[model samples]
Target: MARRLCGEGLGTMLLLAAIVGSGIMAERLAGGNDALALLGNTLPTGAMLAVLILIFAPVSGAHFNPAVSLCLALRGDFPWRLLIPYTAVQIAGAIAGAWIAHLMFELPVLQLSVTARTGSGQWIAEAVATFGLVLTILGASARRPDAVPFLVGLYIAAAYWFTASTSFANPAVTVARMLSDTFAGIRPIDAPAFIAAQLLGALAGLAASRLLFSPDAKPVAG
Candidate 1:
């Protein structure tokens, strides 16, 4: 149990560190070109996600996101008892990671984001992005467990460009980013809606996964 919690904390910490650190670095080097900076942020995050999952999945199932943990619990893949502890550590790890990125970049460590990421469209985008992410996880793990790391990594990388909100699919990531006043930051006022959307998406994804991928479901004939 201790090792599992540690793995979750450490993995989430590294994930946020990579996200915020890359955003800072990308923004500084891109000379105000949003697209270029976004690309810079996208690749490293995706790569680090794959690496982290591969390393930590064996230890704690590598669920760095509260939404993922919750969904897995609902699916009976994770214990209901450990959910709270996992979530607590994940959030703490995310905050620590953000602060670490700030220290590395020499920025204010306790700043709240001023970037406005609001509106119905943005919320819808977040919902869709998270839905796809959760779906990918559930669906892929059903048959191709070995492919989960690569699949998630590639999906996120693509979603970064395609989604308006850049796919802040993880609640921990969203909360942590709200404290950062960087390229990847989202306003604190906007965080609640995003989180709500992500949760809804996660539930929907779980439902879809059950309906489509359940063992009782009939296999399609070629």
Candidate 2:
């Protein structure tokens, strides 16, 4: 249990660090080119996601996101008893990671984001983004467990471009980003809607996974 929680915390910490740190770095280097900065942020975040999942999945299922953990618990892939602990640690790790990123960039340890990312479209985008992410994780792990890391990475990379909200699919990630006044930050006032959307998407993804990859399906007779 301890090891699993540690894995969750560490994985989430590293994930946020990669996200916030990359955003800061990209903003500095993009030279007013939003596309270029986004591209830079996308590659590292996707790559780090794969690496982090590969490193931690064997130990703790690599659920760096509360949405993933919640969805897995709903799907019965994760033990219900560990859900709260996993979520708590993930949020803590995210906050710590944001602080780390700030320290690294020599910015304030905490700053409320002014970036207004609210509205119906962004909320809808969050729902869709999270649904796809959770679906990919659950679906891939059902048949090709070893492919989960890569599939999640690929899905997020694509979601970054396709989704208007930039795919803040994880509740923990969304909350943490509120403290960062960077290219990746979202306004605190907007987080509740995003989190609500993410939770809804997680439920939708779990339902979809159950329908698409029913665990009770019997094998065909020879």
Candidate 3:
């Protein structure tokens, strides 16, 4: 149990570091080209997600997102008793990772993002982003357990381009990003709506999965 928690924490931390750190680097190097910066950030983030999931899946199911954990718990693929703890650690890990990224870049460790990312369109985008993420994850795991890591990575990479919100499908990631004032940050004031949308998206995804797969659906591989 302790080891599984550790895996969640470490995996989430590394995931956030990859996201925030790469965003900072991309912003610094993009020479004012937002698209190019996003591209640079997206590639490394997706790559790191695949690597981290592959590394930790065997131990803790590699759920670095609260939305994913919640969805799995609802599906009975994850133990209900561990749901809260998993979410707690993932959030803590995300915050820690954000601070670590700031430290690495010699920026202030404590900062609230000012990048106002509100509005209905953004909220809807988050819902669609998270819905697609969970859907892809569950669908791929049911049919091709061996390919979950690559499938999730690919989905996120594509979502980054297609979604208006740049696919912040993870609640933990959304909260942690509020602490970063970088290219990937979202304003702290707008975090709640994003979180709400993500949770709703999770539920929608779970429903869709249930409708499409059997009650004894193939358990999702980490």
lDDT of 1 by residue, 5-40 (tens): 999999999999999999999999999999999999
Error of 1 at 25 (Å): 0.5
* Model 2 Cα lDDT, one tens digit per residue, 96-154: 99889999999999799999999999999999999999889888887889998999999
Candidate 3, poorest ten consecutive residues by summed lDDT: 212-221
lDDT values, one for every candidate: 0.94, 0.93, 0.93
**Candidate 1, residue 151: CA error in Å?**
0.6
Worst 10-residue lDDT window for candidate 2 reads 212-221
Number of clashing pairs per prediction, in order: 0, 0, 0
Candidate 1 has its poorest 10 consecutive residues by lDDT at: 211-220
Q: How accurate is candidate 1 locally (lDDT)?
A: 0.94
What TM-score goes with each of the models?
Answer: 0.98, 0.96, 0.96
Residue 105, model 2, lDDT:
96
Please give, for residues 42-144, the per-residue lDDT of candidate 3 as tens digits: 9999999999999999999998999999999988899999999999999999999999999999999999999999999899999999998899889888788
- Name the top lDDT candidate: 1
